[model samples]
Target: MKKLNYLLIAIFTLGLATSCDSSDPAIIDEDDNQSGTTITKAGLITANETWTADNIYVLSGKVVVNEGVTLTIEPGTIIKGAEGQGSLASALVIDQGGKIMAEGTADKPIIFTSVLDNITVGQKKGSNLTIANVGLWGGVIVLGKAPISVSGDLETKQIEGIPATDSFGQYGGSIANDNSGVLKYISIRHGGITIGSDNEINGLTLGGVGSGTTIDHIEVVANQDDAIEWFGGTVNVTNVVTYAQGDDAIDADEAWSGTLDNALVIMGADSDSALELDGPAGSAATEAGYTIKNVTLKGAGASSVSKYADLRDGLIANLQNILAYDFGPTSVVKVNGADSATELAAGRITFLKWEIVLPAGVTSVSSLITGANAGDDTKFTNNATAITAASAATVGANTAVFSWTYAKSVSAF
Candidate 1:
């Protein structure tokens, strides 16, 4: 393992020196050239390693941190993913028992962008890729030995965007507080490659990640699929922002028993729902609902015709202090299916202190859910106790934290 690490470092240093000598005339001295390592990486990380900010790491294909290995990335580090589709898609996968201590400060956030981006090692923004460039590559996938619920009540299941034959793609276990690692102040952009029909990678995929993992200040922009999706995990998140995603911004499925605090979702013109929540496929004791608070969801316009949220699949949710606005003429909140409506009626799923701004001609929240043409609002009668209307918008994620993100630079905030 030690030899492998040395070899990797040597290779990285050699690549950096070569690139700097050939491409960058500004780097004239050997001292500046020795400051960082550059690696075009793929395959498995068998041992613990730390990636410094001075270095640039590029992912050419699917890279996995095997079980019992640790991958630590310093603040301001820029990782790039190559472009591909189907079997050739690229990503960084932290397998079960693997740990990634990627904690960056607000001033120096870590970045994971596409290889097509012209970002340098020390700079935050690239000259090439913008928020409009979407689905350029794959994204991050973290798996842990946490509890999940599958159709057959299986303890584990394979995640999407990866081949089923790869057993390392599987996640789930009995431990609710199982620790994966820490992720803070990270930005992922221009990702979400389609591996198959209706099977595309999310900007950030948390599959059975446990509560012990610390995740905060995450931003995903212009992803082809969901910005972030939790697949039956107890991992809580805070200060998250998703912008211009093609699919749902924040999607919680498989009965993710987590908490989302201070999240902002901004839909693009081609985006779908701002939020998509679903429950477990089968009955499992560990599979529980989620709590989301202080969220601001905004769609493109009436031309987009997307919903603020679709709560379905018999999932229990506690939504509080949410401000939903700028959506099209679609339903603001749809209690999907009969089972979900029953859950909403029983107070298992609740929404409190929501400030909504519907499109033109939409009179009431009742009309939005039941369709303006529908005669009655009886379907949402169960949610009457907890769901209420507010005139002024008061709930949303803090815009201050997004100052370092591209969303802020482009004034999307």
Candidate 2:
């Protein structure tokens, strides 16, 4: 896991190298047959057709994806959202059974950022990384039929906050063999609105996605909510990063059965927990079981509370080979319920032999493990033994470190 500074510097250097060959030979070849009219609003993008962000496609409403269609975005293309356009001005949305083959190379990754780009020498304003600055103004939403348990009835329900419910919104489908598309080497910056208390669209929302969907090398920066929200699916993700999110870094609920490996999260001073696993407590059977490995979480201040908070029923979270540092007064690991504590201690919620470098004045793992019925020690030791066995050979390897400037950067809103 490379540090944040190293990653940014590497990207910046790569940007300079590729800034010269910004030509699209394919554009000229394809435009010869198609009309020269520019697309400025939402519309169905056909398969085998190459789409470019001419004047920043403002999605005033839902963008539908017809079956057997594929939407391909060119590399180095910038998609900007409208500030006043509410939540529809954002970039592309992949409807159920539709595919988005946004294959951006390391040298030419597609960037979805805020429209505001004016900046002074040392000032940071109107940048795409602000939580409230909803430029191009909405995030990305992918709806599929991949085995998901919704909070409400599985009848015809609207995705809250997104208008035009009848047009592009889905009405539920079979979870078998549901395929969205492949998303790799893409960056979603400056998204997530303050929709209301504890409810805002994230940088990327995978709703009812299935195992057939492909996800890799994704990054979310400065989102108002969790960088990535998994609603119910068997999606497997690798090499993911989240930076400066206002809420949790990664949130999973509604019976989300997924595998997350090699995740790096660097939190700001005001950000919330690193991982939050909660099923609507009122509906426990709907919660999902998650398996996670090789996670590195680093927070800035005491404001950086718990790394893992479990509030779900039948939440079987197996965390192994983790390294957490710079925590506040709270525990590095906390199970919100007494029963959860028991399960966690009894090696059920296994926390493999790990290391935590606490802040200068704090040294206690007791607060992290509260509630008991007398068999607490056996559970704790069991968890420790499991951790030891799993993490004997590889521990504290490649911890991610981040160094960012606090200077206020601005983007058009």
Candidate 3:
């Protein structure tokens, strides 16, 4: 028995040695040059290289994206969070200048899920996967050198919480044309919740990104925090979905100037607001220069809530052409603030051609749109040609000017 144990130990050591080949660039080189590198274990994959899943690839630490490189993840690749045990772990971090091209097809989307043992046949279970579930397993953070509001001198402001002296978090140095690659047909499930409240990360956090960033056709499922949080970026996105997130489905703050179109958020029953926008009230200026259109938010909870908008101390929001349904009895669209007169005069919460379908005991649409110039219609639009009771098209189509051929049933949570 002693000899057998010794043989097993020898085999294990040999496997470890093989996995730790210093010559392989993916495992050893932090610069992310993958000319002659081979992936053996959980480590960073340089940009412009293809990564295929051998087993379940667990990211034990931060995954950095070097400049001028593109990280291409093949279809059906499953990236898992580390066991975490007792410490925080970040699954993937795309630094400023690096690009991630995780392009998956509809048939086989890239899945990032938890590492649980129990298996259920049909029920969806809560993921043990989170930033704080173990430790600081932060979600993907993308930084760029685009213009960002600085609290101090240009030399003193940290980029994405990392010091300016650090190369690992710096990207798009001096050069203006830095392009973060495309992310399409990717599903990030059961993420969010890093170190603690302040450090807790979201499914996808864009910090100081630019218009060159490509974001489309992404889904975030059951995240502990917001599904997507944007902090001062100019990236435009389309065809995004957020499902059962613990906090706001989409939280935008810090002077974000992005565009969101064709968004579908199916909130959890107990979840908070579907959309939240705060501006300088939390950090910088009190104005948002973004555009939101063709959005459908359906759930049993509140439709939308803004902390700064109500306080009249945050950024101004431009919400157009939205469809919200099945908000619970207590749900409402509230805008309260000290400077309510000035904020409303600026069309901060303007509603144009919006429709709302409520249950029996919920508040009326007249009460919701009390002091605003939504459109020609003083009352909330109901059951237009787009949203009929008999057979309805998807929410995505209703928000767009063109009609969609594909039909989907809209149900309350």
Candidate 4:
């Protein structure tokens, strides 16, 4: 009887220790995905939070910063996305009314990549992935309350690659100066995961993002879709470098009335164009046009470039001081049909000071631009002037500003 009482007393003492412990419930059998510290962000972030540089964050699936909340990321922080497809795809979404201050200095740019990457803390590049790797995960998405010219002149539209049933997918409002937050010195790589059939997200998607947002010194590498695509809104961007994208390097849609300055586009063979500019789909913001200047568009050698640029959908643009090189003879910048050519003549799509190193045996700079309409042959170039022959290095984007980019480290340019 005395020995049994002693056993009960020992069990009662152990119960007190167990009730006081504060760690997470013990796992039956599990190993940490990564060494040191890893925090998995899943579902929605409902409160203001900060992700410090000391910890690595993993996006489990469809992580969102909910409305009216702010999520700040420290410089040199590394965020990775888990691999999945369809609705299960992982991405960092700053939804409408939410904000993210992802501010990184050039010396310590915030890196967003796939969890499969072998990169660890205090590292910029992983050993396993290369410039050719792509579509490993979904990319970063920023949605804000800004004007968008959608079909039927709707004030809002559902963002692409997201289900319509999701209320968080809606973007656009009347606020032209709406502030989404800041994204600077950020590098997004090996993303563009497919969320649906033939629908892969862009490396950096700005949907109805307003001018109050700050975007600069950004780099996007090896995305399966467009590196950066603006679906309306008036966000001015600066010093952007996109390399090895499977689609257009820069795409503007739905009356994006903003300027893209000092941009560099290193195109891949699967890319449709280096710059794909689209016009308004609705009557609203019909007069709004985009300005693209000081851009350098490079193509893969041989017959790999389908076209230098695709200017269609009645886009209004002021394209000046641009350079393109390393393209094949068949490649040309096209203006769709004659109505678009007439629109070009009316200054809806203006071109100036284009310096192109013509393909081997191809000499005329005007020959590099084409009009698809049988009657509009050569008329598109006739309306424009200052298409000259020159070396790309003499003008166009100052590549030195993009030295902090991962594409530069990999010599992708």
- Give each model's whole-structure lDDT: 0.80, 0.56, 0.55, 0.81
lDDT of 1 at 278: 87
**Comparing candidate 2 with candidate 3, which one achieves the higher lDDT?**
2
Best by lDDT: 4
- Residue 46 in candidate 3 has what lDDT? 52
lDDT of 1 by residue, 309-386 (tens): 788788888887778777777646777787777676666777776667756677666655632113223434333222
Better of 1 and 2 by lDDT: 1
lDDT of 1 at 186: 96
lDDT of 3 by residue, 123-238 (tens): 12233443223222345667776544444413113334343444455432222234677887676766676454445567787766777878877777667777787765567878
Could you list the CA RMSD of all candidates, in the order they appear? Answer: 6.3, 11.1, 7.7, 7.1
Q: What is the TM-score of each candidate against the true structure?
A: 0.87, 0.73, 0.71, 0.88
lDDT of 3 at 402: 16
What lDDT score is found at residue 356 in candidate 3?
Answer: 62
**Candidate 3: clashing residue pairs, number:** 18
Poorest stretch of ten by lDDT in candidate 1 = 22-31
Q: After superposition, how far is residue 22 of candidate 2 from its true place, in Å?
A: 34
Clashes per candidate (backbone, < 3 Å): 0, 20, 18, 0
Candidate 4's residue-wise lDDT over 1-413, tens digit each?
A: 75465456546644643555321111111122344356666666778899878767888777788889999999999999889877677789999999999999988999999998988878888899987889988899999888998899998888887778765777889888888899999999999976666466889999999999999999998998899999999889999999989888999988888889999998887877888888888876557488999998888876775688888777788887678887888888888665567677676777766767778877676677777555443444553333334342455899888888888887877
